[model samples]
Target: MNKTFKIYAVIFIVVMVILALLEVNKKEVTDWRKNFDTNEKSPFGLFIFDHEAKDLFKNKLKKIDQTPYNYYNTHKKESHNILVVETEVDTESWNKILDQVSNGSDAMLIVSQIPKEVSDSIGYYDSEISFADENVLKLTDKKYKNDFIKLDKFPSGRGFSYIKPQVEILGKTVEKNNSDQANFIKIKFGKGNIYVHCEPLFMTNYYLLKSGNIKYAQDVFSYLDDKETIWFVESNAKVSRFFMRFILSNPALKYAWWVLLGGLVLFVFFNAKRKQRIVPVIEPLKNTSVDFVKSIGNLYLQEGDFHDMMAKKAQYFLNKVRLDFLIDTQNLDDEFAKKLQLKTGKTIEMINEAINLIKKAQDPYAHVMKEDLARMNKLLDEILK
Candidate 1:
């Protein structure tokens, strides 16, 4: 069993070492789509190096690390316009944002898709843009109306299909004069306006790096130039803040953690048995009294010592008579015989007979026969009764 356990241990160690080596050498590619974080590698991520929008806000861009609703309620009196980029809005946050925007502060939402509740609340719909060839985007702004820029690639996803009649169009696709497929719209609320843009990836790494593309994004932000502070929501990228999140995020580390937990449980279950104290083996005691008595009896029988046996029997009988009748057994005279007769309810002849046999057995020089011993035993038995 020990040898087998050692072999399994060696195999397990070898497998772990190989896995570690493979993981060390593995090159992992960062998935860049729909990850609109502040990191550089994400296609939609805002970085100071690439996207000019970061420079446009600069120190004025205050990122809300927590949920929008929390920030809004905490700083409700403060007038800060929200800048939501490539983020899915929850109902509660959406409602809060709507309330904040309707009261005084404005908001700009740049994403590939918007939630159904938000879209329904403000008469807006989305369209699926086909990825057959390069998508040509046209800015309907009077200043850049003639500048229709054609792109090799754009963010592949849904776009704003329709908007309310009261919504003012800012940008549209150059394919057709369909206002229904407009990419940008501005909806006026109670005291502020909501700027909605369909393609957030246009302002990301791929398109933002293109020639003249930065100016186009700049022009789009021109609508919100009046706002002093822009609250950039950073909820999606919040997981990067936790140390354990990194381990749980990786497939190898997560699996290893589960395996380690399982091994610990198994060790506790098996090693607990090994830690218990050993139970001692107990031997039963021997009843040697009967055996010793039987052996001594057999030794006398083999030697043919009828004299010794008769003497022992006569002495034991006398001892028993002395103890039971409370009489002196030293003398077996006629008076003793009468006392023995009255005590035992036996005849005088019987007592006399037993006394004569006992006297003969008591004689040291006398050679007693087996028949004499047997007659003495019978006479003693009757006298005792």
Candidate 2:
């Protein structure tokens, strides 16, 4: 068993070394999911946008980590230039945001798909999103109308229709069919104004990294008033443990984790034991009470302790007489002898002789000879019979 264990240990060590070397040379793959979190530096994340927005809005820029309803409810009397760059919205929160905007606050919402509630309320509709490798976009104002931007290599733009009355068309895109569509619009409600844009991806980290594509994002923000702005951005990236972060930072460590797990599973399989055989039943020892008493009697006889043996014999005889005759033997006077005679129907002479022998045996200092012991046993037999 010891030799087998040593062999398995050596084999396991070799396997682990080989696995570690292979994992160390493995290459990592790129992640291509759209997270849009301010903390994430992925291709579709908003890390670049969140960092650069401070320059545009200055010290007035703050982040909202809660729902619009929660923020508005807590700070009911306060208002700011609100910027919402989100794909999904809670209906109640969106309505509350619109209510806050109408009361006094200005808001700019950049979303690819406008919610049905907002579209219906404003009598605005957008055309189906179109995909292209390159597209042309420009503002409506005459001074910037000639400043056209070609957002290249992406499904990055869309068009609009049913723009309704009393709305200002801020920006537009020329579709592949050579038809123009409204991409950005503004409407005044109560004491404030709202700007809604159709192509929200143009504001992400991808467009900001490009040389001239940043002009479009800047031109869009130029419409907002220079009020203190609160941005509602994603805040879902959680703090993680250092050990776990270290393991996940490298592809090699991730593969080593799998290898170690497989090694543990193999070790458990090889060391598993089957149920042991049923234990055998054992018989208890036999009784030896008579043999033990005989052995003790022989030891006393060998030591010549005749007086002590006679004293014990006298006690047993008295106990037997009391139990058999139902008589008290505390006093061994004439009454006990008379009672023994009556129970045994023996002669008075015989009973008296046995009682005298028992008294002599009970005396501690009496020298009990073999002849005296024989005579006492003979008399006791005759009286008890």
TM-score for all models, in order of appearance: 0.59, 0.56
lDDT of 2 at 12: 75
**74-161 in candidate 1: lDDT tens per residue?**
7755555678887656789888888877787778888777667667767756666643245666678789865555556543534566
Question: What is the per-residue lDDT of model 2 for residues 1-385, given as tens digits with 9 covering 90 to 100?
Answer: 4565666667878997887777777665544565566776666678888888889786789888888778778876466788888646688878887887788888898877788877766666665655445777779988776566666645455667777778889998875765677889998876788888877667667767877777777778888888789887655556452435777767999889879878875774566433347999888787899899999978987998777777777788888888888889898898788778767888989888888878889888777886777777777767667
* Whole-model lDDT per candidate: 0.72, 0.76
Q: How well does candidate 1 score on lDDT at residue 315?
A: 95
Where is the poorest 10-residue window by lDDT in model 2? 235-244
Q: Which stretches of candidate 1 lie over 4 Å from their true place?
A: 28-32, 48-54, 124-126, 146-151, 175-180, 235-385
Kindly report which residue stretches of model 2 are placed more than 4 angstroms away from their true locations once superposed. Answer: 1-32, 146-148, 236-271, 274-385
Error of 1 at 266 (Å): 4.1
